[model samples]
Target: MTDVFETDDPETDAGATVLEVRFTGDEGRLDRALALALPDLSRARLQALIAAGAVSLDEAPVRQGSAAARAGLYRVAVPPPESADPEPEPIPLTVLFEDAHLIVVDKPAGMPVHPSHGHARGTLVNALLHHCAGSLSGVGGVARPGIVHRLDKDTSGVMVAAKSDAAHAGLSALFARHDIDRSYIALTRGAPHPRAGRVETRLGRSTADRKKMAVLRNGGREAITDYATLRVFGPDGRPLAAEVRSTLHTGRTHQIRVHMAHLGAPLLGDPVYGSGGVSPVVREAVAASGLTGQALHAAVLGFVHPVTGEALRFESAPPPAMQALAAALSAL
Candidate 1:
């Protein structure tokens, strides 16, 4: 259950972090083993680096899709950390609050938080770069310089970014401790069985679709979601859809949407999870609201101030599309 590694030695050639790992664990994928052996690097980042052919085992190149990394010594060559300073663009940003340490912004739907493979421009980070005027922090490395957490590209609501490394660390710890208060409002097909309840599931990459997440049976990470039915819309006296508010105890990708879908109540307009066969009323509401993505909104966020040691809470009204959807539902 322990990984013995020697990686602090200087690189033999140019910029490299030569790592010699004798993994003692017999479980998990090679990427998982590497990620566990090197806790400093994020699992996702380690997977990316491994997939990029940056590692070797026993003088043989370690394939990114290698079956597993067993109890064996391996050599890993880590290249120099990539720079995160993407070009700053004049992307509009909605600042909700700001100070020397951190800034809160109301991020719009359809805007990615940071740049990655397909999305190289017009991200929130790009806007922050332009607006912060060289004050952006670099503690989070290249993938996410000041990003503490993220919302999906189609979800709109409050998001906070760090201005200083201290704030970034504090916020990251808060998230790790699950001390931050977060709430999301969503419109889902059908009412939940209990009207309000907790959903505890082990989440992992879906076997059916690698791009999506699923409640897995084995070797998955723990995920917890709590939701309550706020209102129900069933114009013809049959339950069609409901407006629900959810609190996340653990943040996994698409946790709420996946859990709700697992409850047989997929969020309205969710292209990935939805069955595309909702009742006429729900369909009409979703279509008329101008929502081309999931009908979910991050409505409330609360946490302690990283610098000032003060409690803070912020609330945001649903976006226009959600507002329209709510109005349509209420009228039914």
Candidate 2:
């Protein structure tokens, strides 16, 4: 049965009337309360609103840093009008391979992989939902039906989605065991020493900024990235382009960017972990290719079919930006 709640009376514009909500003793957190009461909004966005003094309890403003509320009867104020609609927008996608068990898509950069705070619609998942016509498997959840893994919003590449529960389980297991073969192509500022090597580091949340991840010695997970320089040259023999392929033994947040930066080579357009801006030569080359964001792509993905047990491999060419960069480097 769908969860239901009474809406605040429309007569009062002090916002909606205060609706008294009695916690069941277990689900009393402000975030949980808002989630239960307002099922339409995402948990992250609701939490942000609560943190920003937009949500009050019993007319008393709740502290942003406060933990979940204890079991009690509290009045929650209705939120203000939203400035933007989170409705899904239809977008085109490139399908590399599709079957009853899975789908491999050539995801584009700048398009979010899933719906999130500012990106409520026009996501890869939303487009898939529309294109697949409700045929996607409900393995993860209603919101994330066939999702098994995710790529960052700005990262473009080949991603797979399970079309059935069995496929979902099988794919999840493969990823957990590091059995899937995943390869990425990246354009960094400088060539790596030795031209080919592996980087092993422990990564954890940054102490200085909770929002960022960093390589940490004491408290972090082990991350392994094996990279080989595919090509290295410069516009005037000054060392401009470095094309490297990275294979992840252990996936960690910002592993490639962090490890690359650690090796004195950072991704060209990464704003957070590496250099924030792009070089003039790199910018001109990338613009010719008509692409924005970082020059990274999931060029290869390989795995066994969940049902047939047959080996399957998929590869995608670099997007325009990456291609343009390659051509410019070739001339150099």
The candidate that wins on TM-score is 1
Summing lDDT over every window of 10 consecutive residues in candidate 1, give the lowest-scoring window. Answer: 4-13
In candidate 1, which residue pairs clash? none
**Tens digit per residue, CA lDDT, model 1, 1-332:** 65455565453447778777776667568887777778887778777667767677766777764568766677777766544557788988888888999989988888888887657778888899889986777987765678999999889999999999999999999999889999999988887777899999999999999999999999678999999999988753557889999999998999998999998889888999985779787787788889878888999999999889988899998889988998888877
Assess the local accuracy of residue 306 in candidate 1 as a C-alpha lDDT between 0 and 100.
Answer: 87
lDDT of 1 at 153: 88
RMSD of 1: 9.7
Clashes of each: 0, 0
Candidates' lDDT values, in order?
0.84, 0.75
lDDT of 2 by residue, 1-332 (tens): 11234557554356554445555555545676667666776667667766666555545767652467655555445545533423334678899888888898999888887776656677887888877777777877766778888888878899999888899999999988889899999988877776789998889898999888888989799899999988886742446768889998876777887888788778777777666445677667766766566678889999998888989999998877778778876775
